[model samples]
Target chain A: MSSQAPETTQIHNIGYRSYDGPRLGRAYARRALFSQSLRGAYGLGRSAKSKVLPMLLFAVMCAPALIIVAISVYTKADKLFMEYTQYAVYLQLVIAVFLASQAPQSVSRDLRFRTVPLYFSRPIERVDYVLAKYGAMASALFVLTATPLVIMWIGSMLAKMDFAEQAKLFGQGLVSVAVLSVLFAGVGLVMAALTPRRGFGVAAVIAVLTISYGAVTTLQGISYTTENTGSIIWLGLFSPLTLVIGLQNAFLGAPASFPGEMQVGAGTGAVYLLVVLGLVAACYGILMRRYRKVGL
Target chain B: MIATESLSKRFPRVTALDRLSLDIGPGVTGLVGANGAGKSTMIKILLGLSPATEGSAQVLGLDVRTHGPEIRERVGYMPEHDCLPPDVSATEFVVHMARMSGLPATAARERTADTLRHVGLYEERYRPIGGYSTGMKQRVKLAQALVHDPKLVLLDEPTNGLDPVGRDEMLGLIRRVWTDFGISVLVTSHLLGELERTCDHVVVIDGGRLLRSSSTSDFTRTTTTLAVEVTDSDAHPDGAASLRAALAAAGVTIHAGVEDGLPGAGHVLLLEAPGEETYDLVRDTVAGLGLGLVRMEQRRHHIAEVFKATDQEEVPAR
Candidate 1:
């Protein structure tokens, strides 16, 4: 059966090289963070239809409110500055609601689905994951937080409102949005970090932002009525919204509203900024540490 | 190449992976363990998806703890569970994953198409994965893992929910992923037989601890026991019992007969032989008895033998 014999093959020289160096600790962390952010972009792009629908819906809903504010500023050109500033404050409330709805889901969904392992397996460190997640969520929130302020500024200029007043309000709004974005991002990160479940994170964020603040303000109001004291001045610092409102009052030369009295002071604004910074720092620290220890 | 040292994982009540150490080299390495045997945990630790409570691991020369991403970039992973987004089509999801691994947009798209075709998805890749069958879904998962063209791939129970035919097909594709593409694979499965034909190395674990880790050949090597089947006839023919007695008288250890469930249903005798010429001896003995020799072969150890051996060892210890 063997008309032709099968020939045996000979082996050739095999070459190999080895790598040696210091362990890639922090460098790997940086790579991991970049990859995680890229993963976030990939995840969002994969679910683009679902994510884009909600974003577009929000944009549509806000369009009418933006137009109304623009029309008011165009018609009453003298008080345009005041109206736009007030409108910005109302827009912050919408930003708060949007944050409450979206931020928790963004963090909690990964935990619920046990998909954090997918991200952890990448070249991204835990800190990088947290930062990437925060960035992704903050980017989403910026749509609501920064877009209205930008619209109002553009609308004011087009309507030919008082240039000096517009400039002042624009500057204030810019600072306000920056502070608000940080505050929202910190609060959201902290709330999501506290639990891996989506429902609990959302509920926790809502409680901190709305229920806890409402209860504290009510208690402060009662204290003001009964004791007739000004020591409760720091009560606004207990809630992020109140903190923002207090800073806004100080910066715009508006009357600062305590429980019983209205006053104006630069000292209160500094205190509010300090408190926001403290919270953001605490939230970031806790979030990074928690993420590092998280199982997946 | 991968190595682990005293790797362990502890939960609140149960330890998912006990103090287990192992080393795996190039080629297909099959991780076999029952559900909750820490196979997934080991894969996660190796992938840097989850950190071990103690000990250390290295994958492709990168530390699992710190350089997980770097390791993951070089290694691909196909998770055991259903983690695919329902809305996205396979082509879109895999392409997006390829890009996420740092491929350019065009390269990602091209690779995604090539991987999908390689996995046999074809036109079905365009359909939303929510409607995919288990086999199709498995292909999508495999496509995503290979789309990045990684050096190694960790496939966690890639044959989960697959029928025997589907399992064979998946196993064939996995072997091709190594042989055809020259990529190393770390595939996990609950069934050892599923991997016996595919993998070069086998690592077995139970109760969160390693039981055995060796080459598949070492585990499946034939033992010095002959399984013989003889034909019983009406004319002057003795049954398996008579043949067993005849073999026993001839200084051969006749362990069991047809009723002992060696191989065939009837006239099969399990003979314990001391040397390698057991098959020839059994054939000569059966021919001398005037009984037709049906089949005589060495009894190869099944993967199930390992489980039985472990059970026996545990019984004696207890």
Candidate 2:
């Protein structure tokens, strides 16, 4: 067609609605994030295969409590081999493996896929993001460690123990488990946030745990042979696992589970708690700073 | 709506956004730039996800430096690269994001459903995102951004990995995000043609600087040249040559289009139409010469031509 003029313009009305709903502020955003990340740590709302690893690790961590209970019931024994607070020390390797395996599932996946931008672009601050992550991981570890502690208490009750003493022990065990889980959660999340790859994060977390445990044990062993109690207490303060046991021994009135005569006193246990808290604070700082520039 | 004054972003090695000053109103605006032209950097700074090295900006009347949380609450952002986690279902992910945006439990699910349906991913939305196609993943990203119904959305390279048909649908959807939802959209793309069809206004940037910012109509103005195509016939198989001669005899000027060695100028003619009278004259001349007029329309400047013309003119944005 030949035309000197162009086509006419017509406007179409699609009736696009404007949203006038109520939008809650930053507090709601942080609460929702904390809940979501808590689910993410346990692989909740994710695929079946994703759920498998966390669930299996959880079951493995609970095995010793179930076994000790069964043995106590069968033998009709009192005062079982595993103390509630000492459980963490007895299964430190398993707990370390669980933390190494599960921590990356919570934080590193966001970094690996560069989804940190999505999280940071919301109403929440960088500090809020790490806090939510810390809360979620700590909650997951509490569930893992406390379930076994409860099971051991049930076994003690079934074995005709003094109900009063068992209840007291359970209370102390809960506190110890809570504190130790905080330590593990803080360290695990920090290591996971430092690297994007899941395998590298897992290896780094396990290496931190294992290497420190080995170094502290060797030093404490040498100190014990030389009858150097001061040196043993000093070296015990360095490893998180040792400090965890030290805190349990000093506060819960539980006997020392460490090798030889390296019994941690109440003063040393108080120092351990302070130092563990410092480590947790340091981890939180690293996480907040890491995310501040990650989105850019 | 977004406004920036002397905004700049600098890294150690390169400057991303340099003295960018933009005033965008509520509508669908397209930000066009090449790779590494600071498109992503501009979006980040506007969202307050990153700080500007110098100057300041505002989104929805909120300061970028002080009100990042408030601005982010009202503005949705879809990043350029793939950032979806692989293990979660699309519904789960979008609902989670909606909740993060402050929608309650039931409201979050309802909005997630509506947004997923609008993006055209129904049955597949239940599957893990790891198994989704690139188009599906892109749609999921869009769904998450829209599930909470923000006042404005910033979509960066929404059609990066789609086929032609998928690109067309995504472009149409982006246009409707404004038309149907009454939301302002700041969508970016490297391809100018993609924006030409959807955007009401376009801002072109090159090398971290503003090259042009104008309404779509002004950017593509109708020029004086008109294209005339003719069909060969038994009376005059060489219709173009005959038409040119007859028009020249009739006091009409024709420019040399594509050369054809034989003065016939192939099947098309580029006529310089000084006025409406020229079009009628050319039409009457073709009919008088016993030739069929295939098409005759005024040519308009394409968006790509702006870049080529700018290269020659070397004019910066005013």
* Highest lDDT model number: 2
Residue-level lDDT of model 1, residues B1-318, one tens digit each, is: 899999999989999888999999999999988888888888878888777999999999889898876787778888887666665688877875665555655767878887887788888888888889999988988887887778899999999899989999999999988888788999999887888988999998887888889999988998887777788767436557667877778788877434454455667777787786766667777777778877777788887787679868877764
List model 1 lDDT by residue over A147-194, tens digit each: 666777777777777778877777776676666667777897688767
- Steric clash pairs (candidate 1): A32-A123, A32-A124, A122-B69, A123-B69
> Which runs in model 2 stand beyond 4 Å of their true positions?
A1-19, A66-81, A154-167, A226-229, B233-237, B257-265, B315-318
The pairs that clash in candidate 2 are: A16-B180
**lDDT, candidate 2, A152-243, per-residue tens:** 99899889888998899889999988888888899999999998999999999999999999999998888788887678777877878887
Per-candidate DockQ vs. reference: 0.18, 0.53
Top model number, DockQ: 2
TM-score of chain B of 1: 0.92
In terms of TM-score, how similar is model 1 to the real structure?
Answer: 0.80
Candidate 2's C-alpha lDDT? 0.86
